[model samples]
Target: MIYCCNDHVELALDVIVDEYETFPVLRKLKEEEKMSTACEYCRKEAEYMVEN
Candidate 1:
């Protein structure tokens, strides 16, 4: 998923390497560079939430 609020946008979820290319979340991740970074960051956050 992706969250956009005018000033900035962020990745709301993580995606696999292969899923990156066709992930629904990445479709609106904002920038091309930020896309990957967002995915990684969101992935960690997601894991933390799930683990707990």
Candidate 2:
């Protein structure tokens, strides 16, 4: 629902990229398209508890 700060977003991307070890499946999806799958998982993982 928000385009957060770039640093924050990048940090998030970093952690996901680090663990996933590649471009995430979310990157390919539109925000809405992503909602059902990748976005939710990311939200649950990084956005919810850990910022990265």
Candidate 3:
């Protein structure tokens, strides 16, 4: 799974599709869940989880 901020969500989606060759699942993070996660493409707090 890739953790991403709003700005990099599209990039994360592209990565999942390119690497897995399937549609990705995108989930918004809960407020508590956002505490320790960071975006894969940047240092911002992650707002979503992207996976296939």
Candidate 4:
């Protein structure tokens, strides 16, 4: 799942890996080399990063 921002806006949630490529923003995420992830509920930094 990918959050639109740290403010708890979700771009995708509970998605399969195959579905990732369908999201243009997720693709942009890879090109930009950004792997920022956070909790949608608590708004805290995630325990670990999720690489694209």
Using all chains and alpha carbons, the TM-scores for the candidates as numbered come to 0.19, 0.34, 0.97, 0.23
Residue 34 of candidate 3: its Cα lDDT?
96
lDDT of 3 by residue, 1-52 (tens): 9999999999999999999999999999999989999998887999999999
lDDT of each: 0.31, 0.40, 0.96, 0.40
Q: Distance from true position, residue 1, model 3, in Å?
A: 0.5
Taking the tens digit of each residue's C-alpha lDDT, what string does model 2 give over 1-52? 2222322455656676787677633233345643443233334322221222
> What stretches of model 3 exceed 4 Å from their correct place?
none
Q: What is the C-alpha lDDT profile of model 4 across 1-52, one tens digit per residue?
A: 4443334333233242357655333322342334455544565544322224
In angstroms, how far off is 39's CA in candidate 4?
2.5
TM-score of model number 3 = 0.97
Q: Which candidate number would show the highest TM-score if scored against the true structure?
A: 3
Model 1's alpha-carbon lDDT is: 0.31
Query: What local lDDT score does residue 2 receive in model 3, on the 0 to 100 scale?
Result: 98
- What value does the lDDT take at residue 20 in candidate 3? 99
Please report, as a residue range, the 10-residue window in candidate 3 with the lowest summed lDDT: 34-43
Clashing pairs in 3: none
Name the regions of candidate 1 deviating beyond 4 angstroms. 10-19, 23-52
**Model 3 residue 44 lDDT score:** 96
